[model samples]
Target chain A: MAKRFSAEKYVAGILAGDRVMLSRAITLVESKLHSDHELAQEVISQVLPHAGNSVRIGITGVPGVGKSTFIEAFGIYLIQQQQKKLAVLAIDPTSQRSGGSILGDKTRMDTLATNPQAFIRPSPAGKSLGGVTRSTRESIILCEAAGFDTIFVETVGVGQSETAVHAMVDFFLLLMLAGAGDELQGIKRGIMEMADAIAITKADGSNKDKAKVARAEYQNALHLYPRAASGWLPHVSTCSALQQQTGLNTIWQTISEYLQLTRSNGYFEQKRRDQNLQWMYEAIRQGLEEHFYNHQQVKAQLPDVAAQVKEGKKSAFAAASELLGLV
Target chain B: MAKRFSAEKYVAGILAGDRVMLSRAITLVESKLHSDHELAQEVISQVLPHAGNSVRIGITGVPGVGKSTFIEAFGIYLIQQQQKKLAVLAIDPTSQRSGGSILGDKTRMDTLATNPQAFIRPSPAGKSLGGVTRSTRESIILCEAAGFDTIFVETVGVGQSETAVHAMVDFFLLLMLAGAGDELQGIKRGIMEMADAIAITKADGSNKDKAKVARAEYQNALHLYPRAASGWLPHVSTCSALQQQTGLNTIWQTISEYLQLTRSNGYFEQKRRDQNLQWMYEAIRQGLEEHFYNHQQVKAQLPDVAAQVKEGKKSAFAAASELLGLV
Candidate 1:
């Protein structure tokens, strides 16, 4: 049997900026055992005071959009040029069955992975079921407490997880390919609106002109969408991650301006506060669902009843009542 | 003291197409008292078999977009030409504070209100407390049982209620004006993508050219959006609610076409099934929050903790934990 972890020691180690302690705390958070959960909550409570100081950014793009290459160069730029400590986290809920992290293909981000100032943690099992995302949220606090000032959460563009990532991050960056109509065909429309910025990746050599054209087109299309509550208009730009001198500086500048405007107007703080309330409600909702769906009767009857619903043999409300009754 | 209402009486009356009984059943469902809940559930269970026969449509637009007039003409057309019974319902969460239904100004929809084939229920109090929407969903079932073949759930353009209205309806329509940019200035961005059809209202008289131009522009803009899962491209058209021979027929035709495409492709039934599952979960989430927030300790501490969170003196997750701990 494994020895029990001490919550107080974990808290002290994390607040003292120990990376091993941060990793261990994150592991505790991600654990599903009841004892681990109690301890994780305790550690999270103690570390809460030292969190919320980081600028959390969420980046997403569909497969084949050069997300890894872009993140590699951008992460390097932040470390070398801006001297910022960065943490790159992945939120790929689909990876659990595949036994791989969404960022398991680490060769694409080799340089950043080895950087002393950068911390890259692949999502364990690509995804966790139910309350698993609660761990990811906690991991953010642990990272922030350990002194990572710039945090990036990455996700694939073609899934519902973008909304989850959007809720946890301060800025959202969407990557797009130049003149790739097929790529757009696979992307979800709602993801586009959630993005705080869109960057056309791989804008080098022969792709430069097409990337420029794509940038202009996306800019025009974004104008049709309403301005964000923060009064910030999402920006579109082009960058080549493979270039010796990438266009990372301009991207950082846009982020700086956004932070300046929103922070000065108090939108940033207000958004974070709203996010907190949202997470609280979300956690409560998830707990309720787990309890209801796990009911002995509900588990036994769901499949047959759900099939009846799909065949239109039963009204949804009636079916709901029948299920709710069992609980 | 009034005699307790029998669930069996309400169910029988609803199945027999009694409007008064239907309204009473709805009232039972909407009642917040714990005593009414079991009876309401029983009544709903009995009425469920008679429901699911109606075509539900959701209509939304800013206040000045002539939604009432449009519905007035549209409802009349359905009855006179299509020979369909219609029910117009409103979901106004904000109506409570204003002391009336958002659509309490029924004079705008005078013809529809008085028409024998039409049943128009002004939203009671414009909104209710937690799970008010659950009752709205149940009211939909009662309306279907009462033999209304067409259902329209209307919402204001500028609020969060549109998402709720969207969930219960089969088809969503956005009513826009020829050049009402100011009216749309307050509208949110995602609502545009939710529409199955966009109608440019007030197309008669001097506004004809502007309406046509707006239609073309919107048509092009719709093309730029990712295609809806149903594979039916949202239609854009002009309509004149005040004109004797109006463009209402074309709008109906577009809706018919949408229904045909989705029905043939099986997306129609699938969407409804998904919506049912969604509602089940939504109901569960709402229930959990009501329980937690209503906890005596939580209710007492919420304002101060929430204020602290808003002021950035506390982390959101930590504040949430404090509230959750109380519960």
Candidate 2:
């Protein structure tokens, strides 16, 4: 087990922009121990006042989409050019099963890892989606309290983690390869609708022309979609991490424009407030389901009841009623 | 209250194709009384063995998209031309707030309503989405057992009801107008991906060319989406209910082909099994939330706690933890 600290000490350290204390507090948040949970909640409550001051951006793409490289280049640009303190975190619930996470190797982003203005934390291993999401959310608050002005929560694009990431972030950016057909199959449906912007990665050299075609195709496709409640039309652009100046500036520019629009329109604050309420309800749901499913009677009967339900031998509502009656 | 019937009587009446008993049983399913709920579950369980023999289809479109006329024409075609017993049901959870429902006026589908072979049931008057979804799901079973070989579950395309409808159907058919841009805004995001087929409605007269264009556009757009798990690519066709032969047969043919493909590939049965299990879990979730929110302490403290979470004065997770502790 990791060493622990008082909630006050952790809060003070975070507010003072002490990275070591922030990391320790995050460790406590990720820990599964009951005692750690209490301490983590306490620390989170104390630091909550200092949070919500940063822009949380969710970045996702399928495995071969150059996510790490993009983040590396983007992180450097943010710190050097934009004069922003950036923190990178990930939510990879499948990491334990996959034996490693997308951000597990810090060397993938060696330069950014070494940069003092950027903080990068890999996804916690051996955790469920709920656990990872909760910790990542708390870690964002801790990072914000520690003086970071920008946050990027990364997730593998082909999984359920994107929805969780989308819920927590102020903006959702999807990365895509140039070719739309074969490579597009790797992305899940409904994801396109959630994206605030689509970035066509590896848009240099031979891929440049193909990237432009894909961008136009995606732009037209997005136009067919219903307008987002935020009233912002999703933007599609091409960028290359190798040639940092090519589309990186455009990408950041788009984000900044989005921030200005949403903030001025009051959507940014309204969305954040809605997100806050949504998470509380989500957590309550998780807690209730956990309690019900973990009940000895429910646990024993669920398999049988579920089997009956699957076979259509029992009405799902009646079966559910029977199970709920148990606890 | 309507006169009560024994569970065996209801089951026998349903299996014997008594429409009056089927309607009464549905009324019991839609009731809010504790006694009616108990009786409804018993009837559902007894009739469960006679269910699952129908092709349950979900049809949805925005308000101005000729949904009622299309369903009326489609229902007549299924019953007269195809010689199939049809049950048409609506799931308008917004009925209570909207002052009336899309299907509330039987005159909207006068011909279908008068047909001896067709069963038309409007959305229950005043119920939560959960309540309507559960009762509608049960009503489908009742209709199936009453010898209806085809079921059409209709919903206005602009709301959350489509997801519920999608979860309960074998094939989801989305209706659209010839002109896609202006009218398409009324559809909720993610609804297009859920469709098994998109029917461009009102293809008669001057709308014919526009409908053809819309069909091609949607077909091209659907190709960019990740292939559905059913291995059936969604089909897009133009239809005109006014001129019944225009595209109605093509729509039915597409549905028939989808049914053939999915059934042969085992996706049809697999999806039904998954849906059954999904509804069970959905019910459990609803029950848990209802119990949690109705707790005296939770009911008293939720507004204050929620305001704090919404204002960022408390971390959502921490607030959820506090509320969960009280319950």
Which candidate number has the best lDDT?
2
Given candidate 2, what's the lDDT at residue B100?
40
lDDT of 1 by residue, B119-153 (tens): 88766753443365677778888899889999998
Give candidate 2's error at residue B312 in angstroms.
1.2
lDDT, candidate 1, A1-327, per-residue tens: 234568889988988888877778887877767667667778887888788899999999988888888888899898999899998887776676543476635666889888888888766753344454577778898999989999998888887788888888999999999884654465676788898899888899999999899999899878877778999999998888666355798889888889999999999988998887777667656655666788999899988887876665665545666777786
What lDDT tens digits, residue by residue, belong to model 2 across residues B156-234? 8987889999999999999988775754466765788799999988888988998888889889878988778999999
Q: Which candidate should be chosen as best, given DockQ against the real structure?
A: 2
Name the lDDT value of residue A177 in candidate 2.
Answer: 94
Model 1: docking quality category: acceptable
**TM-score of the second chain for every model:** 0.92, 0.95
Assess candidate 1 and give its TM-score to the true structure: 0.87
- Candidate 1 — which residues are off by over 4 angstroms? A1-4, A94-99, A125-132, A178-187, A213-227, A231-233, A242-246, A297-327, B1-5, B97-100, B125-130, B180-187, B220-231, B242-246, B300-327
- TM, every model: 0.87, 0.93
